[model samples]
Target: MCLAIPMRVIAVDASGLSATCEAKGQQRQVGLIMLDEVVRIGDYLMISLGQAMQKISVEDAKQTWAYYEEILNFSPSH
Candidate 1:
């Protein structure tokens, strides 16, 4: 299954189509070409498949992370 993770935009590249995002204390470059809203540093983006799909509010970011925490708590027999 694929998941869209909410990440905080830390830096934007000169090209405007890429950005460095921090999530879970790690930073990664993600594509911003797919976003409709103008992205800025400290913005929350919903990332999926290496791309930013949409801009989300801080509250939304918190909720998404809570969902991720829930997923992490799941333990299934492999």
Candidate 2:
């Protein structure tokens, strides 16, 4: 199964072709090539396999992330 995580857009590149997103306290690059809408900073996107697949509302992102957090709680950290 694929796991798509909701990540908050932290910084958009000057070209607006890519962005930096933060999720689970980690930051990574996300491509916006597949997206047609204007993706500004602070937007939330559903990311999977190193790509942002869809844009989601902040409220939805919060709820989804909450569930992920709960799931993470069940797994032990090294």
Candidate 3:
């Protein structure tokens, strides 16, 4: 299964070709892929497979993080 995670963009290149994102205390490089026009530093993004899938509003990012926190707390039944 593929998992998409919400991350915050930390920096963007001058040409908007690439960006640096932070998630769970780790930073990664992501490609703009035509989204650089709308995205900017400090924006939240939904990322999958090392790519930014879409930009997410601050409120949505918070909600997604909360949901992931709950999932992390869950224990599988034996």
Best by lDDT: 1
lDDT of 3 at 12: 87
lDDT of 1 by residue, 1-78 (tens): 888989999999988989999999988899988877789999999899899989999999999899889888989989
Give the TM-score comparing model 3 with the true structure, all chains together. 0.85
**Model 3, span 1-78: residue lDDT tens:** 997889999998887878899988999998878464577889999889878888989899899999999999999999
**Model 2 lDDT at residue 48:** 87
Better of 1 and 2 by TM-score: 1
Clashing pairs in 3: none
In terms of lDDT, the poorest run of 10 residues in model 2 is 68-77
- The positional error of residue 30 in candidate 3, measured at the CA in angstroms, is 0.9
Best by TM-score: 1
Q: Looking at candidate 2, what is the lDDT of residue 71?
A: 91
Instruction: Provide the lDDT at 8 for model 3.
Output: 96
Candidate 3: residue 19 Cα off by (Å) = 0.4
Native-referenced Cα lDDT, model 3: 0.87
Candidate 3, residue 6: the lDDT equals 91
Off by over 4 Å in 1: 75-78
Write one digit per residue (lDDT tens) for candidate 2, span 1-78: 999989999999999889999987999999888788889889999988888899999999999978887997897769
